[model samples]
Target chain A: MSATAPRPNGAPPGAVAAARRYGEVVAPYLVLAAVWQLAALAFPSYLFPPLDAVLARFFAIVTSAKQFTDVLATLWRILAGLAGAFLIGGVIAFVMAQSRTMDRFLAPILTFFQGIPALSWVVFAIIWIHGIELRIFVIMVMTTLPAFTFQILGALRAISKDLFEMVLSFRPTRWGRFRVMVLPSILPDILTAWKVNLGNASRVVVVAELVGATGGIGYELLQQQQLFDMTGALAWTLQLVFFVLLVQRLLAWIETHAFRYRAASEHSL
Target chain B: MTAGPGRLEEPVVRFDRVTKLFERPGEGTFRAVDDLSLEIHAGTRVALLGKTGCGKSTMFNMIAGLLDPTEGTVTVNGRDPFREFDSFRGKLAVVFQNDRLLPWRTAIGNVEIGLEMLGLAPQERHDMAQRWLTQLGLGGHENDYPHALSGGMRQRVSIARAFATNAGLLLCDEPFSALDEITGQRLREEFVSLVREKRKTAVFITHSINEAFQIGDRIVVLKRPARIAYDVKISPDLDAAEKEAIRARILDELSA
Candidate 1:
């Protein structure tokens, strides 16, 4: 039986299903906002600003061209770093999957880098790189490379040998084998890695900006904090949250469209 | 077009003194196929009948070039499939025990894979894939993914994939073992008729005596360590009682 059986009442099931799913996602955020508002009622405004005050400041920042530029700058850095990490990390992962020698040589190195925190890299970048943009980019890439590489490697390893054998029986070229078998088999994993590293790279970009960068949301956040502008800090924090959620939603939308062939039960997180 | 009688006289597949050994982590080594030699002519349908772990799949893998024999030579069309893997690029196809359809691809997409490998034009591949899927009774389900199709329909898609390649040799590794009896019978009939009409050389691997009787032009019963225990040619003229007797004899040989 089809998993998405149409409703008996002749309504479009796709619209109804989408609405229900969106409601499920929004419900928790609404509840969390309510809880935050209640907490704001019990605290002083300077220490714990009300939701409305923070939101008002958030809107004010969003409307200002300079403040919006800060948001764009942070986004550009994160996207650039992540795009580089994805390309470099994807090549490394493919090499690791194809060759045992490469896997052995790279496994311990990846593990070592993974053990070093993003903050440590930010400091190292500050010492090593004079340019602020390069420093933030380096820190973001270092933070995300290991996770993307390993996730792609795991996806490569999880491909069934039986399927490979079946494809092999057709005697495809190495490139054909990869296109018809490897790429499709590991696509879900690649998308998952992209989602994970997007979140990670976003956070690391902010952290790197906080340390030494001249411009971005993190820089604005630091400035607001030093001046004891609690509402502004909270508003920037809200912007950060909104940025992360926006990226996640975009990735989710891409995943749903790209992997429409996946069963409903196997929907990605 | 009907396949002319006795058109396939040349030996297309040969196994000479073939042996395979597998090493377990702590269990040393186990012999999967011993020094067994066999030859199958072109356009002949042969069934290698054996139970699980009886080396039927191992033998199939040897011919498919996924595994190399440790002790002997396996040649397809006068060339070693393992060593000269590229030589069989468009000449061989396999229908695995499981459908093995790529979950991310629809029925038509899955069927088009071999054509894609063969470097057919997009329109040509699309037309070929669509025709095969439709011929296999999956006309309207071509857009469905494997998860959306039933077990039987998924197997049909797999069969369509193999046929779409238009390969000269078809290797079936228990292609219908996962389906229910009725579905299996229907697919087996369709598959047999297609194979005969196209005059393709086929090697079907199965553990069922009845399945062998139904589909095999010649049946070879394999004993453990995989030597041939019985080699019998099936004639279309055999009565029901004679067929039953042959099945009983094959079962006895397997049990022995």
Candidate 2:
């Protein structure tokens, strides 16, 4: 009695829709590969290596423990920098949200830090700090801290006064109130802050490594650039890109599960 | 029944010449509550009734330890609720004008908030919340979020939240004012019965005369800036004629 007839392919409607979604995800990457392959056919292999050669290098980097250590090193720097930024930013934001004087005093400083470039932080860290890991960590924290602070402060300010007062009526301990009210109230923005800062951290980590670090993906990319090996360059770049994409998908999945309480409208913004 | 909290000689809540003043941006000082002295005995329901802006909520907040009285003392259980706010950990609870359910928490989770604060074990609090939900006619809605519930159901969840803590003092600031007429009436009846059954010392804030009558045994009508204009007790044994006379007096007090 439905208006549309059954599909000729005999696939369930849900499966068909899922297939279409998967197709949408894969299409752009396929197109990019085709374009790169065409360029490889037209040019010399040094300038534009074919997709197969780039993929071969990608596997080689994945398989060789020494080469793969560079990948792991980069991953660790990105994660550690982001974690450092998030913790420092959370404290600053909490203090700022609690006191208007602190907010006024620190807001301008954070904004000023936000204006400073990642490369400048790399230089400052190299001059001011001692070690490579510490330098990259400082660069990552300085670059990403301001945005996290502002996002968390905004979330804190936007908590419902009614809900706050309701929670207060129970006379919870300071820690209890934070666990019950403050944490959940600010978690959505916290997750979003991480997602936004992840991209920034990844980019900033590479820049820091290019300047100061002797061993991360940026160092490897520098090696590729020096050798003028397009395949190696493409392979290393893909590693970072793939890492970012994987993390973004993981964050999206977390948002879905954590915020499932949100009402789903027929149309989305 | 043996009286534990109800038999205490000291007042459960006492407002000794309390006055609350809020500083407006350009209007200078706005006196929301002024020179009001009141005593709420244990196990008695008191409805502070007035027009909007009469500072009923101000008084409610004072009792709930949310606001400090600008001039005089407001004490609950013989201690200051605001200055010594943490002392009343399991002693007081509130039902606000809106449901105020945490949107991210499920119905049972919201109910378990105060229990969580009181450090009840997970299974104990879970069972307590489940029982409260069942008692409120929301037995199967323990997992529904605020957005998934209707207004009436959400308010019931809030009510369940308030009662689950088993607090001695309950402060409600027009908890039923947002619902439709029929829903409001039903909830009012249920709420009043619950309060009586639990023998809680409750301070209810409301604007409706009928709601005050339904909710409180002792009704205190307030004038502007929250001075008690007329105070009367509605005894259960009163006849219709006597009830009508008291209603007329309340009408006069409210109108005047």
Candidate 3:
């Protein structure tokens, strides 16, 4: 016989462990769905649409070409705004890292921007910017730019001086230094910055759409609100939710592969 | 590249009255090295032995082109290593106190760092790095990340990194100081043999008297603020008595 009793069903220990972990992750969400379904049985369809109706609407929104366009429009706005802010923030962060005067001048201004509310920027964008896409883009950038700049700045500051000096010892060219040392050092923080700003941008874009734009999830939600259709509201909201979840999973996958070199401890934070 | 043409008479490294001072926040100027002058000839192993705050690292930094001398000139290969830093791209290498391996890089990848800077072909660098790794007893560990290796093994990889570049000069700043006694001694022997075989000019900074004796043909003991206190030449033919006298002298200077 084996040293001890074999796993039930003769499954390998690793597979069993993986199955348990996945079950733990799914258990809470299952409970949440059950609770929502129970609430739907008691309340009217307008107040709390049944899960099956919500699922049907969610499928219709995904399957229908015109309806899916709104979802795609929102994603495009979010990505465009994030890409613009990330590029600008990276340049600003680099300048800040290089010069004390630039850092001192720009840091406070960014902090001040961070304090201004997202809705306030939407209002400002409505007043100042004429084009719908430009207005939404400006709002997205304003809301998320500071966080991107600050996070990247923090990462830049946190690079080990010893490691930097070691790479410099080889007398790398400026671009070589960046490709060899600076990029790898800052990448983890950059990914995390994208992860955070992606969420913030998604939320901010919807708000910008509601006020200044015509076609997006937020605009669709406006239509649902006027009609008082709970099913459409939940379904559209889930579409955005699904999109966020998909992107988040993609980011997580990248993190796993990119950071596999990291040593794991038996006890992790 | 060794010493530059017309500067053939000049040593590989010459520091003429170098003084490095730092201004700490709210503490005024703190002098780390004061009016220090030294010369290191090519193809020689010179161990710089000093106390904790005797400016060994300061001098090392100056020679490596990382720091500018405040008062005087530091010339490596007969050029200002700082002002003419880029010109020494593949001429010299440094093995620091810590291994300083790039965590994202494998052992061989870290070894290929200098070769990359030199614009060598990937296959050529890979072969050079692999040979160095294998010579350093890290043959199978070429693909292992720095975190996966032990301290001694990681230090070996760093040694491979410096040597793989085929740099004529190697500056070591207490590379084995953090290792266990046995492992440190073993690496020290391996390092000495490699240095001898390559015929590379080296300046090793350390505080240990035994290490100074083990690695250096000439040991230069330093006092506080970076002035040389004792400089002596040791011969291989010297017996135990001759070696003891030099050791005693180094001890006296260090205690003083």
Q: Write the per-residue lDDT of candidate 1 for residues A95-162, one digit (tens) a residue.
A: 99999999999999999999998889998999999998888888888899999999999999999998
Number of clashing residue pairs, candidate 1: 0
| Docking category of candidate 1 | medium
Candidate 2 residue pairs in clash (backbone atoms < 3 Å): none
lDDT tens digits by residue: candidate 3, A125-212:
9999999999999999999999999999999999889999999999999999999999999999999999998888888988899888
**Candidate 3 clashing pairs, residues 3+ apart or interchain:** none
Evaluated at residue B76, the lDDT of candidate 1 is: 90
lDDT of each: 0.90, 0.91, 0.93
TM-score for chain A, prediction 2 = 0.95
The TM-scores, one per candidate, come to 0.88, 0.96, 0.96
True contacts kept of 2: 0.93
Ranking by lDDT: 3, 2, 1
lDDT by residue (tens digit), candidate 3, B1-256: 3456776566899989999999899999989998988888978999999999889999999999999999999999789999999999999999988899999999999999999999999999999999999999999999999989999999999999999999999999999999999999999999999999999999999989999999999999999989989999878998999999989888999999
Write the residue-wise lDDT of candidate 2 on B160-205 in tens digits: 9999999999999899999999999999999999999999989999
DockQ (C-alpha) of model 2? 0.87
The better-scoring model by lDDT among 2 and 3 is 3
Question: How well does candidate 2 score on lDDT at residue B250?
Answer: 84
Best by lDDT: 3
Deviation in Å, model 1, residue A161 alpha carbon: 1.9
